[model samples]
Target: MNNALEPSAVALGTAGWGGGWGVEPLDDGAWAEAERVASDALAAALEAGITTVDTADIYAHGRSEQTLGRLLAADSGLRERIRLQTKCGIMIGGSPLYGVDSAAAVESTRYHGGADHVRRAVTDSLERLHTDHVDTLIIHRPDPLTRPEETVEAYLELASAGSVGSLGLSNMGVAWVRRFDDALRAATGGEEGIACLQIELGLHHRGLVESAVLVNHPDSADRAVVGEAGGLAELCAERGIALQAWGSLGQGRYTRGTEQAADQDREAAAVVAEIAGRLEVSGEAVVLAWLLKLPWRIQPVVGTVNPDRLRAAAQAPVAADRMDSLDWYRLWTAARGAPLP
Candidate 1:
């Protein structure tokens, strides 16, 4: 968190910007091309008013951070203008993984966030990112092997040394966040805590919002948010932890007009499309605005290289200006495929 302000609304995602990610992964040649495209996209994104870029060490097996490093190295001035946030903890093998379904295997990376591993991870990330300090350093996943107290001690050490600023989490549960935060506060004596919660949340995945909307229904068969109390969302709201959403535009499922999630997306995208048409904005903007209307302000992590798309995404808050409260629920229900009980 290099003393930079938090990304106000939306952040550009560099997951696909690196090389190997998304529906179809790339090869060596394709990866080179991807780096070129991403560098160009990053320039366009900064010019388009996006100040935050989210990436991870495992992304493209570190090519993501390396590519970003190259860009930053070339333009020393760009370093100050933008905030760099990268994650680690998950490691990737040499194999080039492709497609969305197969991409899940990458998560199986052994989660190791002990003092030694966090120290090594941060050092390696800084080396790859080619920066002295990152605006925010995130733990990609919880390490079952290490206790929260032990992990936060190393994190606090980094923060004190200015090697890292704000701490973060990804794909983590509520209990874990609480444990980590408790440990962090104990270590710092209430001086610092998690800066944000990055999770898979959007029109395509409403687990965070669904828990609140579902109330005490306790029905997991119909919705993914029903199982637990979804204390994370509540905690984030109460604690003022900004909720940053990944895959906010359905990850091309909605905007591409592709039949990625045909049955489910058909109805959801229809409502979003109708709204976008009425508002005269891109479909991506509409979906994003819907997420923004949640109780907490959601910072969207969008992966788009096209300059036009980046600017269109920046218009999310404005596109939402035309939406009424009723229309907001309409979009939610459409995505849920069922009216509120």
Candidate 2:
């Protein structure tokens, strides 16, 4: 990945900013407070050297991007320092997440990857982001109806027009990635393809790692993570694409939100706490460092909007540097809640 699109070891996720997902309805004053929080979080991210920020169009029904845009507009230098990434594909309709009431909101939300949808989505995203182009534009989800060729054509046009720097995929399988890349190569007759793949990965969810370790187990394939069916991590490494881990902090199950953790997860939290004590770092740092120990160089997207937490999580790389293999396995075994089969 070029410097323009290359992400830091840690990325900032904006899902919690500007009235993010699952948030209750907020009045105008409450929303203003949310924006203020978002601004502080962005400043914290920059201070911690987090170069990339991830968001989706459906996030806060565009408030997240609008908030980011306003921040970028206010500080001309901020736009030059940070790389912006946003996703499209899932079309949002009336939903309580956006403070809208509709009985069929779930039915109203659908995925579209047609040429028209891709073009319009990027164009609209650019307008909301207050940028002429995005550092990376990811497909938020797989669109069963649209052909891969249509999506690739749209992506190429956007890249050619200088509207998108790189392409990425999220919540997609290896087969889908191959189809898109194959179409891209056939059209361009070169090696250019996807630049990154984002998926949910953390101690709370070890399906990606389990898929590799449980080779002969009967339930191995069934339990495989959504994007790990065909060795997705190895594939991304071979193709020179970055593997980014969303939900990398495990929703604070092992850290701040232990009160709501299940019994099994509580056990894992204990193990994390042990490691954190030995290392003299916060539990959040240990959790993120565990991901950094992976050979694939997985980029953990820290979703917390709290500046203090973000600064703490940013120390994960340093923690990983000091963590030995035995310590890494100890945390893994606790999360698995059993010895390797």
lDDT tens digits, residues 1-341, model 2? 22354578899999877766543566888778877999999888889888899988778877788778878777877777888889988877564432343345344787878898789878978887787888888998889998888888898899889898888888776788777767777778866888788889898777778878777786675665433454877777877778889999998988864566788788888878878888888888899999999988688988899999999898888889888999999899888878877
- Candidate 1 lDDT by residue in tens digits, 71-109: 888787877887878887775533242123445545454
Q: Native-vs-model 2 lDDT?
A: 0.81
TM-scores of all predicted structures: 0.89, 0.91
* Candidate 2 segments whose C-alpha is farther than 4 A from its true place: 1-5, 21-28, 95-107, 219-230, 257-260
lDDT of each: 0.78, 0.81
Error of 2 at 255 (Å): 0.8
Best by lDDT: 2
Off by over 4 Å in 1: 21-32, 93-108, 258-261
Error at 89, model 1, angstroms: 1.3
Clashes of 1: 2
